[model samples]
Target: MNITVFCSAYSLDDRYSVPAAEFARLLGSGGHTLVWGGSNAGLMGLLADEVKAAGGRLVGVLVELLAHKGYQGADELVMTADLAARKAELLARADAVVVLAGGLGTLDEVTEVVELRKHGLHDKPIVLLDTEGFYAGLRTQLERMEAEGFLPRPLAELVSFAGTPAEVFELLAAAS
Candidate 1:
């Protein structure tokens, strides 16, 4: 399985390394490939490093601007001129998406995946690693969209939520 992990650039820290490593270890143990933002910082960095350390094939997709931010870790790099292009490239090849706790950038990328599911552009599974209920408000707003009929129920269900990386990876493996 090839999984694309959607995550925030801001939340990268040593604190996040263990869970990231756990997720990578699980996937590596299962003989799956890991794909993610090619960043050297935050959760993105941790995931790529651990996945590679665990002997998994890791691919990094990064936008030009973000790459200049000095936060990328792709043994193999895909450089896009911009963020939108970066997402497009990832969407083209990733069979699944796991969203770790992140901020606006993370939200933006996840929104693209949601919209992609909405339009039937892809049936790829999306799992949200809630990480301490990081996505509580976001889920509420998505539910509100469902209530307003702005988003269909099935579309809203495109994203599964888990409080731990273990659960998120389980959902992702099932998706595969």
Candidate 2:
């Protein structure tokens, strides 16, 4: 599977890094490809390193402004003119999407994908790894949206939340 992962570009605490690394190892050892932002910084860099070390293929989609920060060892790298194009390319390359703990940028990426799925623009499975309940607030908001009839489809059908690295793969496997 070509898994597109949206995550922090900033160096994170061990609490977040540990799970991200575990997820990377699984993606690599399982003979999958990682499709992500083409940055060799922070958590994004760590994920690429772990995945590459574990034998996974890396495909990076980078925006022009961040091209200088692109990973040196990606199996393939694509340069986009802007963030919107980058997101489009990322989704176009992914068989599924996995979101790890991140700040606003990561949130933006995941939100766009989810919205696309909700509009029937794509059917790819989207999973969020809720490490340390980092996504609890978002989950509550989404649940409220579901309860309020704001969404046309069931919340479960739109996205699934997993609590660990193993659970992320288990959900992906079942979805595939």
Candidate 3:
């Protein structure tokens, strides 16, 4: 599967970085491709490096502004005009989307994908890798939205949560 991973471009926490590499390793070993922001920093870089070392295909989508920052040696690099275009391209090429521990940018990407799915733009599986409870608040908020009838359907129908990389793969296998 072409798994689009939304994660932080920068993080000081090993808690996030360690699992990011493990997830990449698993993806590579499983023969899955990785699609992510093209940057040689933080979890994004770590994941891409691990995937490449493990012999997996890496596809990076970055905007012109971000492209100058440097890439983590993606086998295929796609440059976009801006962030919106980058997001569009990422979504267009993904068979599935994975949300990892990240900050504001990651949140934006994940939320946009979820909203797109909600609006029937696509039916791709979206998995949240809640490493170290990073996404607990977001999960709770999603549930609250469903309980209040703000969502057209239950969030669970659109998103799956996995505490570990192994569980993420399990969910992906079942989804496939």
TM-score of each: 0.87, 0.99, 0.97
Q: Give candidate 1's error at residue 117 in angstroms.
A: 0.4
Candidate that would win on lDDT: 2
Where does candidate 2 have its weakest 10-residue lDDT segment?
167-176
List per-prediction Cα lDDT, in the order shown: 0.76, 0.96, 0.90
lDDT of 1 by residue, 1-176 (tens): 78888876655554455666687777766676777778877777767767777777877887787766544445578888888888888878688888877778888999989888987889999888776667888888888787788875554357888877679777766766
Q: Model 2 reaches what TM-score against the true structure?
A: 0.99
User: TM-score order of candidates, best first?
Assistant: 2, 3, 1
Please report, as a residue range, the 10-residue window in candidate 1 with the lowest summed lDDT: 66-75
Local accuracy of candidate 3 as per-residue lDDT tens digits, 1-176: 89999998885577888888889999998898999998888888888899998989999998888877657478889999989999999999999999998889999999999999999999999999999999999999999999999999788878999999999999988998
lDDT tens digits, residues 17-104, model 2? 9999999999999999999998999999999999999999999999999989999999999999999999999999999999999999
Scored against the true structure, residue 39 in model 3 reaches a CA lDDT of 87
Displacement of the residue 86 alpha carbon in candidate 3, Å = 0.4
Worst 10 residues of 3 by lDDT: 66-75
Pairs with backbone N, CA or C atoms under 3 Å apart (clashes), candidate 1: 12-42, 38-72, 39-71, 39-72, 40-71, 40-72
Per-residue error (Å), model 2, residue 85 = 0.1
